[model samples]
Target: MKRLWLIAAICTGAVLLAFAQTQQGSPTPQTFLLRYKGKPGDVSRYKSWFVMRMVGTMPTPAGLREGKMEYQSEATYLHKIISVAEDGTLEIETVKESGKARMGDGERMRDLPDRPYKRVVKMTNRGKVIESREFEDGEEEQESEEEVAEFPIASRRYQPTYWLDKLYETAVHNIAFPEQAIKVGDSWQEKVSEQMTPNCKVPITINSRFKELVKLDGKLCAVIQSEIDAPIDGQDNVGEWTVAVKGRFNALMTIYFDPELGDEVQAIDEARLVLEITLSGPNRPTLTITHRLISRGKTAKLD
Candidate 1:
């Protein structure tokens, strides 16, 4: 349960910078109302890959030396919006293309044969995630002891699908535009929630500014800078294990939105998180799995 919680928290931690102004000529003194614009059934494809590394000490027993473990994951995802609402909310669906995860690397890497995992997200134009549902075929993923042990950290079914987690994080943690338009240097704030548990919700603070206008892939894009912070601390009973976690999570993101197309054409983002954990249960002994997670990725629109 400790490891499971840590994985979930890491996804939340990505619960997603500051680029100081450069001598590049100031952006036109024009305010842009950045929002997604598309008619119902209008489709768009997004492809992105991110690498996450966890390095730190794991929890130790009462009299034992502090044990430590670290691992790396690399994954690619394919997503497309299938529908849109009049209010700007949209429904998205995606699946993992391929990748190595948890301790599954080197010659041990096993690509999911069927790629039977999928996720559907309903998100508001302001970038809030209204609902996210996951689907996977268990029979298609039956594996051996060695295979199951390698993916012990991320999910209940022992499937190393961190990309789905990344997709979930992207859907839930994102920009919420301000009501009014603004020019470069204009700043605003937003508040969202992270579901630590059914009854416990943690508020996440997001500060955004219209950093500048830049050109990418030959299209003019609004370069918005943002700072995301979440102080997550809590405990809960998850099945047979008793779990507790506390940590500070933060990220810096620079998004390039295509105003004319009303869609995000590209984005560069990174995040860091440090957490302390404690756990106890029948077979699962108390564990720490202290970790610092670093994530780097890029997302771009394809038509």
Candidate 2:
């Protein structure tokens, strides 16, 4: 259970940190090539995707509950979101799957790779996302009441709405302290280590300063790992949380700056960010997120 929680923490933190790259004096309007992977030996039955559900204790008028209740569910991206910034900076939001819909017996969400979604994102000059809107393209809209009633569907969307610098600010809150890791309602402490990148050419070096921070993605993230932790369910007697696995695993992230892909001083491109992660605490596990950059635009428009 500790190892499982560690894996969940690392991967989910990585994704959130990567998405929260917007920080003070950092590059703006950037996009990255994202890939998330996870493989917890005995923690879960899910191997293909990361599941965010309810667990742990909860606070109530009566007392503390043994297990939390679940009210929402959504998974991180198996595929990545690629976007070119207007300033020539390539920005890749550590992508993930997130959408909730009500169904017959239970709620059904369109949060799979094959499922399609339309989103509109607006950003500022500093690469801060101002707003995000989702387009509801219902597939079962035409179904009959009986059929639809049998499978009632409602949808929830997770969108990014902040700049890299802004997210950086959020992450600082998750930085580990001696007392106990507490800020966003949880506390944790783990051994941290610093690891260098595979090659020396990469500007960013891998290190053990791993910590969690809140961001516009509706979760907390770690800098070295693209992991995420968020509230999934909250109601009467139960509660649940979701954790997205690592992106840019093995502390190896693709760096793409101007000159190679687009403008130089304005952007950074990370390919397969969080593709692999190392687990060595109580549990020995390693997960690799597989992602490929299909294509990139000349100038990304955020309006």
Candidate 3:
């Protein structure tokens, strides 16, 4: 009888736990009201002011490291080809960048590349990055693996698809799937999620919506960054990302630009956005991005 009672108690506890989880599932979607004054650059032109602070566990070739850092970046870009004619090539260029990042203990790092760090992308019309070469300045050979792993590093010499993904995800509503195109959103809210790989399968979730146009720096600019929820990469992201540790997260972020920059103001196009993503799961770990900053500098303009 005692053994049977123990079994019953375990089952009851499991039921209650499930119920609690269900209750927490319906989280009130966090919202941010960002009102700023900026110029409304043309959608075709590119101009941006980006800032990011991220803290999470990062895996390096040597092992894992923990730290926090922030970066401020600016850029001007031009879209050389929007809809290419048959046999025509598309091009993007970066004009300028003046940015720095603060590592743990406020150690300043400098010398980052600008926008359009030189990459060749092949994608269907639906806006899915099929394949491309990630930028890597030759400096990797000079530094030891441990030295290279230090945080708050910056370089803008090369283009990375991950940054491109951020830019495309924010603006492009539809993406090309293997067979057909998948619509990210049609109306009010849009949910964009991606599973980053190599170290572990850490999924990133970005929830955004169309906010009103606000004036910034005496120019009309579009403001975005409704909500963002991400799990710590590495071990913490183990066991399918759940609602508990991963869900108790929110962000207040904004994307601003002068309409004069137009489509050039796209997130990744304007500058390399390296945000310090935070993760508070079973183990407490902090990580930072120590990589290229920005290289190209081209003013945003219509093709």
Candidate 4:
């Protein structure tokens, strides 16, 4: 009888050991189907900041001259969902709460007017822009020669208005997600084309991967990593000058998204670009410009 009891105890111990080994061998995978879940009257407040630095070298009659220019800007944006259709279309009103910029020799410009700038955007639930409109500021648009010549390459194309427009557009478009639910380690690709000017088109291809789902500021968030590649080659008329630009761009972006809210909580984008510019005139020397840009944005409850 003692031998029988000993045999029974050993059998129980062996079964327990086998169960533990099985548990350790198979780990559950982390996966989720991310979608936007929001309703009308939902409000989100966003703050964005960008810093850009450019170094250019141009050939001159005297010799080669090099110049450097830097620009920094910050803006607050308020987004309100006006209506949500059953089909998942959203009408959103975006207001520029405030903005300020600094350029040239590191002198901070005065703050923008107290009045809010406004824009209306229509988008789909999957982060596609259907339409967008910018309210007029009522001031006549004018460009001074001094402003045009400030930084020959960027001054003409990269203005405060352009930056602000791009910023709002990005916020409205958000991220391009996959059609089906994705799990960690899954990857996807998207193609984007934008008309930068009348004759210039910028084409970008992005590769994205789901990195992980982790807690951010006490909120569960999915982190996505993306790589952006764009090549630019176009000619466009800028005021009295016809400028030709050829460049290559590369960037990396990390986005923190709240799956429940269906919105981006935060994002960081860093890019490097190199361009060769040729103006439309005799004896015009080609200018080589290298630019670096960093942009960041965060969103929170309005109240």
TM-score of each: 0.66, 0.23, 0.38, 0.71
List model 3 lDDT by residue over 1-303, tens digit each: 001111111000000000112236574422222211112231133344444444445677688776655454444333223233243222222222232222232357564543233223333332333443334234234434334233212211111224333433432322211222111121133345443322434344445543545675556555443344444333223232211111112333334433343321223222233334332333534433333223222222223
- Model 1 gets an lDDT of 0.54
lDDT of 2 by residue, 19-53 (tens): 23557987653323222222222111111111222
Which has the better lDDT: candidate 2, or candidate 3?
Answer: 3
Model 4 TM-score?
A: 0.71
Task: Judging by lDDT against the true structure, name the best candidate.
Answer: 4
Every model's Cα RMSD, please? 8.4, 20.5, 18.7, 16.0
Candidate 4 lDDT, 169-286, residue by residue in tens? 4322444567666777889887776676567777777788988888877766788777877777888666656667777666676767666545566666665666666766446545
Off by over 4 Å in 1: 1-28, 59-81, 95-114, 139-174, 197-201, 236-242, 280-287
* Per-residue lDDT value at 9 in model 1: 16
Residue-level lDDT for 69 in candidate 4:
62
Query: Which ten residues in a row are the worst by lDDT in model 1?
Result: 9-18
Any residue pairs clashing in model 1, and if so which?
A: 17-252, 17-253, 59-288, 59-289
**In candidate 1, residue 25 scores what lDDT?**
72
